[model samples]
Target chain A: MKLFRMLRRHIRDAFKSVFRNFSLSVASITCITITLIIVGLSIIASLNLKNFTTEIEEDVTMIVFLDADTTEEQISTLTVEINSIPNVEEVKFKSKNTSKNEMMQESDFFKETMSTWGEGDNPLKDSFQVKVKDIEKIADTAEEIRDMDKVSVVNYGEEMVNNLISAFSMIQKVAIIMVVALIVVTIFLIINTIKLTIFSRKREISIMRLVGASNVSIKIPFLIEGLILGFIGSIIPIVVIIYGYTALYNHLGGVVYSNLITLIQPEPFVYIASLIILGIGMLVGMVGSAGAVRKYLKV
Target chain B: MDLIRINNVKKQYKNGVTAINNLNLSIKKGDFVFIIGGSGSGKSTLIKMLYREEKPTLGEIIVGGVNVAKLRNRKVYVLRRKLGIVFQDYRLLPKQNVYENVAFALEIIGAKKEEIRRKTLKAIEMVGLKSKIHNYPDQLSGGEQQRVAIARAIVNNPKLLICDEPTGNLDPERSKEIMDILEAINKEMGTTIIMATHDKDIVNRMKKRVVALKDGRLVKDVEKGGYCSEAI
Candidate 1:
């Protein structure tokens, strides 16, 4: 009962000080808000980039064209051989007639030109669209398929795919670095702000010390004040992150063209991001106030 | 019984200045003792040493049977809890009302709500500021502020009340009222009062036990002494 009363008093004093020093408290909250906003944006950017990269990885497929003169038996055998490759996930065979028909249905110019050609005059070659389990091994799998019998040409946009992978990986690294740097800067700013608040109340602290207030009693109010500031600071940023991400996702109409690149769905992603922001705000506030109050508590 | 015992206590500052040198003194329980000394004569240092604010460089200061010099930082609050200290500057929290300022002393020590209300009101009444309890420190005169400081210092009913020039900023009439309160507390409640002061008139008028210091050494101690050795 005594401990509960003391905690109540400490919490009351914490709120009282925050209200009494309104300007300083606002400044602290502002610093935390801005810092968390930057952190939130960085997180969102990293998440989107991650999703886009995964889309790219899944979209990469090796197109293996067979020799035009290959017989049906040879085409079937080649299909089985291609499917047996280590990293090949699935091999889809496209007959020349089917390919020609798809081309004729896709465009009016192709239909006009292809209507005069018979099945025997079809110029399209039979090909296999090979999807791979892993993007990194796609190039090696394509290379292996190139040396196979009846294989005429292999194309998976090798250079473009590698460049895209590297670019996304670099973005991921940079995003991590940016988020870490922002957190460090936020902690420094929050600590200094809390130090100022503690400085203004140094007289009160000394008076309490002389009056026999224990160190824990003296520290509890400031700790609570810090937590309140951090909590208030995170609210705006979390709202902004959720709102801004939803808006961006809607504005983009979809992920990227071809439906491969996509934004993380708003529901669970925003909820998780909000949790992260709240956690960072509270943790930073605790650490900053704890560090600042330690020196002045020597009395 | 001796409530405070100082055995060959010596205090040297970090700058190599010796504030109290080879000082030895003792005060009995319920005794109203006046520490009379000029500026820089180590009157403040002696009072500070009693509260464990400044540790003696040489010897032990046993207050209520606890060695203050050997006490750790964490235990200092425990020792201070048993004592009340009033300063010359009247260190009242400017933002707190008179009532809250007095109650703050009790609040910090985890006193019960009813006990705090009862004791805080009682202390404020003793200081003769019952009507002005709602006023802030800035709204009060220097004497009234000092009274609030006194009320705060005594609110916890400390075993020993140490006042360092408590009436230094007040006029003669205000000083008399403050002294009268302290005297009443000493005589009526038998709380040990050790006051450091330069107010010769109040000291001479009170005719209490006086301990005088000169250049960090105890030069005079007398029973029923006046402001100066020759005056009595």
Candidate 2:
């Protein structure tokens, strides 16, 4: 019952003070909204960028050429064995003639390279293009494929996979750093705003002090006010993020024209939006309230 | 036993100026005592000590069983709940109405809603400002504001009511009215009243015990006291 009463007081004071200092309260809310909206958009953009990179990495494959003398029986057997390798998703073998025809389709010059080979001579050998679950394991899988007697040359370049992984990690690190900086700035700005409000009401606080109001009574209300500001500020950003991410997806789909860039699914946008809202809101509110209340409540 | 006790109390300013030096005094319950001192003679500091706003430099002040000088910040307000402090400036919040201002004291101490309303209305009526209860402090005169302040201070029904130059800003007639209200509160409630004043006419006319301070020293203690020159 007492706890309820205390909570009641906090809520009452928070609402009263907001009405009491309407302009300052509105300014604080606007500041938080602008800051959080940018933060939320930043998060959504970075996450979508990450999803695109991962899709690219997953689609990458290694082509392993088999010895020219290998029979169709050997090629099929090798394809089965490669498929059984852990994390190797699927192994597809393109016969020598089929690869040559596909290459020719890419460039008319490749047809000349193929025309020289007579019917008795096979210019190209069958190759297995192995798609692995993880891009990082591409090198190991290719090395294993090369050691097989049926394979003559393993053409999977380890450097390309490594570069992709490194690029992804770099982007991840940059996103994390940006998020951290935004959070810190959010905390700093909110705290300074709360401090200014407290300074404006110092006279009233002294009167409360004179009346012997408990430290918690004085602090809880301001803390609730900070929370209210945080909550109100985050609403615009969260709405913007949901609508913004969906719009970006539709825009990306139209702009790419080739269906090349993979878009983020709608489900993850919720997780991202929630992360942006609660992460910045709770941190900014709790920390700013604590700092301001410490200055006002003597205890 | 004394209701309030001050033993060899001393107060010093930050710039090495001493306001009150080795002042000792005591007041019994139901006694109407007046503290008289010239300006800068530590009247404010002495009043502050009673409320635990300013602690004595070197003495023990026993008010309602607490040693105020050694009290913590949390304990200061607890001590204050037992006190009714009326300031000269009337320190009423400009935004609050007369009723809200009076009820604020009870609210801080967690008074029940019904009781706070009852007590606040009763206190305002006691001060004869019932009609002006809804008016803001800025709308009232100096004397009415002072009366409102007194109502706020006494709303909690504190055991000891301390008035520091409460009539300092009022005219003679207004000052007398405030005094009359305080006297009625004292007579009706039997609450101990300690007033610090420089107005010799009012102090003398009230025919109460007077404690006089000079050069930061308590020089007189009288029963049924009159303001005489020897004390200064």
**Is model 2 an incorrect, acceptable, medium or high docking prediction?**
medium
TM-score of chain B of each: 0.96, 0.97
Q: Please provide, for model 2 over A1-299, each residue's C-alpha lDDT reduced to its tens digit, 9 standing for 90 to 100.
A: 66676678669878787777888888888888888887777777677677778887877878888788898788778878888889799878788888777888888798788878765596777788888997777778878877888678887667777887998889978987898788678778878887787788777777777776777677777878888878877877887777776777677763244566666776676666766686678668767876777776662
Candidate 2: tens digits of C-alpha lDDT, residues B179-201: 99999999999889999999989
Interface quality of candidate 2 as DockQ: 0.50
Report how far off residue B100 is in candidate 2 (Å).
Answer: 2.1
lDDT score for candidate 1 against the true structure: 0.88
DockQ of every model listed? 0.65, 0.50
Fnat of candidate 2: 0.48
Best by lDDT: 1
Candidate 1 per-residue lDDT, tens place, A1-299, comes to 89999999999988887887899889899989998898888888788877888777887888999888999999888878877777888889888888889999999999999999897888888998999998877778988999988899999998998987788778878877878887788788878887887788788888888988888888888888888889999999999988888888788875756577788888889889999999989888877777777777666
Give the whole-model CA lDDT for all candidates, comma-separated. Answer: 0.88, 0.83
Deviation (Å) of B167 in candidate 2: 2.3
- Worst ten in a row by lDDT for model 2 chain B: B223-232
Off by more than 4 A, model 1: A66-97, A108-126, A132-134, A144-153, A251-263, B229-232
